[model samples]
Each structure stands twice: as C-alpha cells, then as structure tokens.
Target: MPIKQSGKRLRVPWRKKLDENGLPLTLPTYMAYCAVAGALRPWNRLGAKTIVTLVTTDDFYFPLFAEAARYFSSQIWHPQRYHGNVLQCSDKNFRHEAEALRDERAILFASPSYQIQEDDRLLSDAVVSLGPRSARHAEAALRRAGLPITNESVELLLTEPWSRLSRAFQDRRDALQAIQRLRSLPKAIPPAASEAESPPSTPDPTLSDMHGFGSSLIEWGYDLAKDIADYKAGIIPWRDVENGVLISGPPGVGKTMFARVLANTCKVPIIYGSASRWQEAGALDEHLKAMRASFDESREKAPSILFIDEIDVFGNRGETDRHSAYMRAVITALLQLLDGFERRKGVVVLGACNYPDLLDSAIKRPGRLDRHIAVPLPDAAARRSILKRHSGVTLCSADYEVFDMATEGMSGADIERLVRDARRAARRQSERLNSLHILDNLRPLVKLPSAYVHSLAVHEAGHALVSHEVGYANVADIKISRWRVEGEYRALGCVEYDVGADRPRTRTFFENAIAVCLAGIAAEIEVFGSFSQGAAGDDAADLNRATELATAMVGAFGMGHTLAVEKFSPNAFARMRSSNPELRREIHNVLETELERAKSIIRLQRAAHQALVTRLVDVDQISGAEVAEIIRNHRRPTVSLAKPERRAAR
Candidate 1:
C-alpha cells in the first residue's frame, strides 16, 4: 500500500536520521519531524490520527526520525522498511502519489531531495512544511510532522547532541573497556630457576673517598668509618648477593643517603627506580622489561648497583604471595638473573623499603635480601656529633654538660634539621658563626630541656628506688642528667633500673613493673606537687606499652592465674586500630591501679624522695660524685636494696 499521512494532512514522518556510523545528522531530521507534526496537529483536533511512512536512507537523519516517531506515536506511519515513505526514483512519482491522497486530506512527507510540479503538489496552505534546509537541498527532502527549524537552530542541534548515559555510567563503561583490553594481552612468560647469582663488590671495599662526598649520611652519625672498616675486613655479612640487599627503616632515618654511601663504598653506580611507577599507565610489563635491560646495560660497567627503591609494592598483589602476578614474576626474574651472573664483575643490587614487614618472604629468603639490620634513630652522643657536623660548630667542654642533656631521644634527621634551622637563624640575624645561634634555634619557648631533665631524673630515680624497695628491677647508677644520647631531655630526673633478664610474669612482679613505669611520674608529682607536660609524650608511650603487656598477661599470656580463661593474644594496638570499645576502660583501669600504687610507695619513702629532689634541683646537672654525696649525706646507700641484673632489654 502507499505511505499514509495523518488525517490532518502533515508531511511524511522522518525516520531516517542516523548516518552509517550510527551518528545522527540532526538538523535535517529535526526539520522533517517538526514540519510533519505541525501539519498533522489539525487531525489531532478530532482525535489521535495515525500516519504511514518510509525512510530510504540512514545518513544524518536516522536518530531524529526514530525519536520523532516515538514522541508522536504515529500509528498509521508504521515504516517497517526504509523505502515505505520515500520513493527515490523521482519527485514526480512522489508528488502524484501525494495528489492521489489529497482528496483523503493526507500528506506525503518525502525526502527534501525529491521535487514535485506545482499542479501535482498541494497548495502551500494545504500541506504543512517542516522547515527550510540549512545545508544542501539534497538533505532538505526529509520531513516530519509538527516542527520548524531555521538554519542556525539546525546547525546548533547538529553540532551539540546529548548521550543517553550519565557521567558515572560512562566511567563504568570505560573501565569495562579497559579490563577487556587487559584480558586480550598475552600471558607473561615465567623465568627459569637457575638464573640466580650474587653481584660482585670492588677490590677496595671501603672507598676512602667517601669522606669528601658531602652527603648527609656521613654527617648524620652513620658511622661511615666503622661500616668501611667492617666491609674491608669482611666482617659485615653480605646478604642477598644473588638478588640484592634490602634496607628497611622508618622515614627520616637517612635510608636513601645510606644506600648511596653503600654504593659509593663498594664503588658501584646507583641505578635508582621506584617500583610504584610501573603500576600506572598499564605499563607493568614494560617496566619489567626496562628493569631487565637496565641490568644488562649496567653489567658492562661492572660493579654497578641496581637499586630498586621501594620493592615492597613490586611484589605480586594477588598471587599466593599476595603481590601482583607481574610484580612477582619480575621479582623472580630479577632474582634468577642476579643468581645467574657468575661474578657481578662489579655490579651489586641494593633495594630500599620502609615497610619490610609487607615484603614477600621470597625477597627476604637466603637467595634474596638475607640480612635485616635495623637502622635506628640516633643515640645521644651521635646526636651531639651530628649537631657539630651540620652546625659547623663544636661544643665547648663547659657546654657539653648542657648540650649532651638537650638532645636525648632525637633522630639523626632531627639533628640535621635542627642544625639547618640554627644556621638559617644565624644568617637571618647577621650573627657570626657561634654556638648561641644553635641554642637559640633549638630552644623552644617552653624550655622543656631543663624541666624535662629534672623530671626524668626524679622519675628514673623513683623507678630505681621503688624497684629496689619492692625487689623487682636492679638500680643502675641513677645518673641525674646524662644527655649524650639521641633525644635527651633535661629531666627533673630519671632513675636507671635494670629491667632484669627474664620478662616478669608474676602478678607482684607485673605490679612492680607498673610501679617502675609510674615511678618517674610519681617522683614528679612528689617534688613539684604536680606533673609537667614535659613527661606527657614519654608517659603516654610508656603507659600504653606497659598496659599492653599487662593486658596480654591477663587476657592472652595466661599469667592471670585467676581468670583461667582461654588465652588469646589480642593485640592492643590492633584492637585500638579496630576501635574496640573496651580498650579505653581496660587501659585506664590498669594505669590507675599502677599510679595509685606508685603514689602510695612514694608517700612511704617521702624523706628519701625529698632528699633526691632537693639535690637534683640544686645541681641542675648532677654527676656521679654529687649523687654519691647526696646518697651519703641523706644516710641512704647509693645502691638499691636489691642487687642489679645485667640483662639487655629488647
């Protein structure tokens, strides 16, 4: 049957808007739909009228035609195939068919490319027009009912179109596309088992030239001379000769600089790269290939160091080892290659990571990173030396008394930062190179050192006295103010007590342990009638540690002896991490018990406590001689009642 239009006599329904690629050429489609719809509205006055239509082409107008049909619900114009509405041969056939239907008051909406003679065509008032074509007349033939379009409006519609999906939906689609792309790549090949060998160090293991490198490692109390001496004598254990050495430590301990020193000492070139860079840009395989190439390139220069910085992330993320498959494969390949190279001829592999705990076991086994040496924060003497090196000033013998006490508990990096800040201040103030600049730089407005020193001494002294009296820890020399170590604080005072060889397990001993930990605070409270914030950080740390051990004894270690409950080692720190509700109560109760016990003990030993505080405050910096004098003058033996033990603490 011939195509039918609405009873209102509108132009043909536009159904062909999409081009070959499924994109819409919207301008012509809009014009066709608008003209046909507008013309057919007169038919809708009676009721909804149906239209029949056909579209021959699928370029520029396809989407618009479909959209209009859906919007108008034109039932009569059910164009199942492309040729129903448009007869492509000539405009005359199309116009004659339209005239044949003119008596029925139906309009035929044909493509704009078709032409009809005026006699055959309906009068302008009888037929509804979609709109004029914006582009070539070839595109103007297509029309739809109930719309009109100008050139600018058509261009605007064609230029800017809308997508059905939302932004979030688009992202999900993109991710799916990427995943599909990844699945298409070939599987990576695994390396053979026999390719593992250690890299070779230089003939002169200790390169004395390190003295001139001007790096922070040398000045930060790294003990270069000692490391060099040990290496020269072969006293230092060479770990992971096959894979590489993995150095682990917390941040700001100079790990990177230390790695550089090791490379220079062994006379090797440093090849630095981070394992994380590979995870981005879908470039893991490429990164592995580059790593292998790096080994080959550096081998020619023998004794070069392949430093894989942050190797923990390089491990396979989801394999049996919990690392990525590619990462594990790369690590395996690296280890095998390292093992295969007979003599590094001068190549060494060194790896650095702050998180050694997260590393794969394979990396730390005999063939990989075998030696684990802890690079701790600096001690007091090291801190003093570090200050001298960075500040470019030496402490006088007179100031050593004060200088040594001021730097306790400090790290190497801390010392360097302090020195740098001191120098900057000097430069700012236009002062000559002097020690006062350093003092001014390091001195906080709170003056924590002196107050902290006195408090620590008294605190430590309380621990000694209480431990001796209660028969727990042995009393050490009870040095009033020794500040030669890293992070030294001038204390009100601290007493040195031997924590004993065995980990105390008995209830009384545990109580004593609490007492000993609380002794410093007890001493502070006794002398000052209040505690200083100087002890706040240390007290919290010590309290938490002691509480953990105590809780473990009660809950997990089966030391409670009364509870008789199933022993389970609940990690206090981990529990805290998980935000367990009971932790606050349990920890608080334990601290309170210990604090009350400590207060009572100090009250009983009130006289001796007073004498110790008086002497400590008078001297500001007490020596062994002064401690002994105070001990004699007070008629109390300097030695604790209990004999001291010689065990080292963990």
Candidate 2:
C-alpha cells in the first residue's frame, strides 16, 4: 500500500511486510527482525534445525534476534512446518506457546557456529554474519518509508544497544531518530569482559604508588598478592589463600583502584565484572550466560583477580519484589558462582560497592566475598602522603601543614583530582608546581591564594567559631585547598564542625544555624572594617542562606512576632516575603538581630578572631583542634546568652 507523506507517496517495504505477516515489533525486535532477514538473505532457505552461532558486537542483540528469527520464520515459507508441533526444535519453544512444543517431537542443541544438514550427515558452509549488513537492510526499509539513517549509524547500531531506542519508539518515535539517539546514550553495552579489565596501569603510577587505602586494606592487598604468588609456587593450598574479599566504601574512595593495585601487586591479570555489566548483555538468560563466561574467563587466566565493582546489585532471593525476580535470579546465580569461586585454583574474587548493606547477606557469607575491608576517606597523614605523591612537587613542612588543613575529609580519589587540577593549572602558567597551585585546585576559587586566602579563612572560620559559640559541638578544624578532586565538588574551603548528632533541633537549633550562616559577613565587618560582596554569591552565599533560614523561622516556624503560617523552603520564600510585608519585616528583623548577635560575639572574641585570621592566612587552612585551641587561648569574658523560646518548626 502507498502512503502519502509531506509531498510524495512512499512505500515502506518492511512496513508492508509487517502488515502482510500481521506482525508487531518494538524497535529492538524490529532491528532483530532486520538481522534475521540479513542472516537468511544468503541462504535460499533456513534448513531444519539450522544450528548456527554468531557473535554480535554487543550481546544485547542475540535474544531479541532469536525472537525476531522466530517471528520472521513463522511468517515466511513453509510456515506450517515452522510450527512448534511439527518441527519442535528450539532453544526457546521457538514456534509456539509452551504446549505447542510437545516433548515427543522436540530436538534441541546449541552450536557455536552455522551448519546446515543434508541426508544423515551435517554439512557446514559459513556465510557473512547477521551483522551490519542486516542492519543496513533494516535501514533501507526505513529509508523506503521516507526515513533515511546513516550507514555508519547502522554499523554502530549493530555494534551496540537500544534499550533507549526501543523505549523511545514505544510512543511512535521515528526509527531514524531512535537509532541516532544511541550516539549520545552512555554505552548501552559496556566493553567486552576482557576490555572490562582496565588496560594495565602504566608504570608511571600503578596503584602501588597510590596511598590512602587504610593500613588494613594495604595489608590485605599485599597478603593476597603474596598468597597468589605462593599458591602459584605450590607453597600453599587454595584453602590457605584467602578465598575472597569484599571492599566496601563510598564512591570516589577508590574501591576499584584497590583491585587494580592488588592485581599489579600480585603480578597477575585482573578481570572486572559486575551484575550491571551482565544485565547489559540482554535479558535474564543472556545475563547469566555472560556472567558464567566471566567466571570461565577468570579461570582461564589463572592467578587472576575478578573484581565485581557493583556486587551489591545482586539482591538475594529473600528480597524479592514483582520487578526484582530477575535480580533475585541474578543474585542466586552469583551466589552459586561465588560459592564455586572459592574452589577455582589460582583465582581470587573481590567485590566493591558504595552500599554493602544493600548486598545479599549470602554474598558476604563465609566463603564468598567474605573478607570485608572498608576504604574510608583518607586521614590527615594519608592525605599528606597522597598529596605529596599526586602534587608531583616538593613540599616543605609549612606547605604540608596547610595541605593537611586543606585535605581533611578527602577520599583518595579526591586527592587525585586535586593534584591533577593543580598540575594542570600550574602547567598552563609554565611554573613549577607549588602550594599555591595545590591549594587553588583544592578549592576552585583558590586562584588568588595570597589575596583571598585570609578572606576564605575568615569566612569558614566564622562558621566554625560561631558554630562553637552557638553552643554547638566544637568544630574539629577547617581546610582550604587548590587541588580539585575530580568527583568532589569544586570549592575553595569548607568548615569541618559538628554539633552533637543526637541534639534536638528546636527553635534555638534553627536560630543558631541562622547565626552561623551570617557570622562570616559579620566577622568580616567586625575585623576587616567592611564585608566583601563575596559574602553573597551563588545561592550558597552567607547572606542568601541566612535570608532563607530567617524566612523559614519567621514564616514557617512562627518564631517571629506573628503566628500566621506561610510556605517555607529555601527558594519558596520570595513570594511569602513579597506578599506579606509583615512577614518580610520580621524576617529582616531576625537577620538583623542575628547579625548583631554574631557581631557581638566577634567583638568579644576579637583577639581569637584575629589570631584565627592570622593562622588561616599563614596556612590557608586549619583543623578544628587548632580552632578550639585558638578560641580557648582568647576566651571571651563570661556572659549570659538569651534563651530561645520554644516554637513549632517545619
């Protein structure tokens, strides 16, 4: 049938064929149908029990094409013969529903390659695979329907996936547009299993050179490396070697890096795998197949490490939901593999994830990913070592003192980025790497380290000092940095302080927060004689934040003069602040009162604040212990603070 488009009549052959066969296919199956047509194009016919195995660039295509082959076969020549009852040979129930493939007539086999049989003997003739060409035919059919896509895209399409492409087509999306979207989707199929093993880290900085994996983690890594060597040398039995380990931590803490380091230390190859990778292979069955293949591959490459980066994704059977049965099966299958993994000689398994709590209990049981080690954010000493290695420069004691302050609470990965950014910035200036570069990179705005260092110190110090004076927990310390860790947010400085976690957040609690938020500008005004506009930039600005908090207190908490309720959230304030002039006035009054309150504290703690500014300017960072010591040295005269009245808060 002819269909009229924008100007001309168009005949889409694939559409005509689907109409003729009463076939319905989503985009994936349609692509699969195209692959089948391409596979059968060379052959005059698909001979009986035609056992052929071919590889696709991405495993995602196999199952979908298998279904497509069934559909296309059903609609083609000898359609009756193709019925399950008559032929009854399929990996699937190929031609029909469950009952259709009766036990009596069924013949099933799997082959790694194509073969067609004549007489009693099987004959084989290899043909070009059902790959790019088939996809090209599918594109041609779409082009016939007045939709043309690139050959390169078709080739790339054959190489990878379209979970997104298929879903996009669910709402009558154009076939060309759907396939083209794959150009931007994050690899629908990750690299092959072997490619999954990151190419060996170069000698420049193998994981061995890296620091910040806690001593326990470092000890386990070396022990495992030694065990692998001893096992290979016949000095120890497989049982004597640690069966497996599960390294857990937050992201950017270098859980995966530890595995690579272990492999390097062991002098063995490492193969990385994860449940998510297997899932990308296609459906449940294909996922299992890919997973099993990874195990086999690890065994093939003995004395190897199989790192499962997302071991937590394999949720055990007990945690089943309607949608989780597939994952349940995955978890069950993984458990079976991990159980058997212990017996695989010369092979070790390691699992990593941000949330180990979400992992199957069985996976972390006695013989599986058992030896759990947490990779915490590096400590001050570890950060120093990491910075020294990554900064690629010499540092004096003073530089390190400042760096220790800057790098507090940073993960190994964060340190890595800081060093990288610092180097890049210094490189652009054609200067040798220095503390300035390192500090600047740590906080993106540390560019004017000499000029702005004291101000950022003053700002963050204000937060900490007020956090202290506001009857919150004593601040531990604060840091400023130039080095930027890749995954960490780009920033100049952050205050490391905490009130008691279990402390109740009453009206006083919020009021205290408002004071801390405003303290930076207040401190600036008290000492520097004026506040810089830097006190208010971005939504995180001290002034902006104080305003948001004050609005919440006045309008939502009903802590102000009036008891009228109003919507309260950070950005939700502008309307209420605008419409209710009384609310606006009360908010302003609260901010003013808090500013005055913070200034008074700053005034009393002038000696301490000045000392803090001097210390911060000298090092560009300081720890809570230091902050505490400084504040204690310049203690304020005893005075009573106004008690906050009880008020309901949002």
Best by lDDT: 2
Candidate 1 Cα errors over 4 Å, as ranges: 1-244, 267-270, 276-282, 315-326, 338-347, 397-432, 448-458, 471-495, 502-504, 524-542, 561-570, 573-600, 620-650
Predicted structure 2, TM vs. truth: 0.45
The reply for model 2, stretches above 4 Å from the true place, is 1-210, 214-253, 260-271, 276-284, 293-306, 310-350, 353-384, 387-394, 397-451, 478-490, 527-530, 536-593, 619-638, 642-650
User: Ten consecutive residues with minimal summed lDDT in candidate 2?
Assistant: 4-13
Q: Each prediction's Cα lDDT score?
A: 0.52, 0.67
Give the number of the best model, judged by TM-score: 1
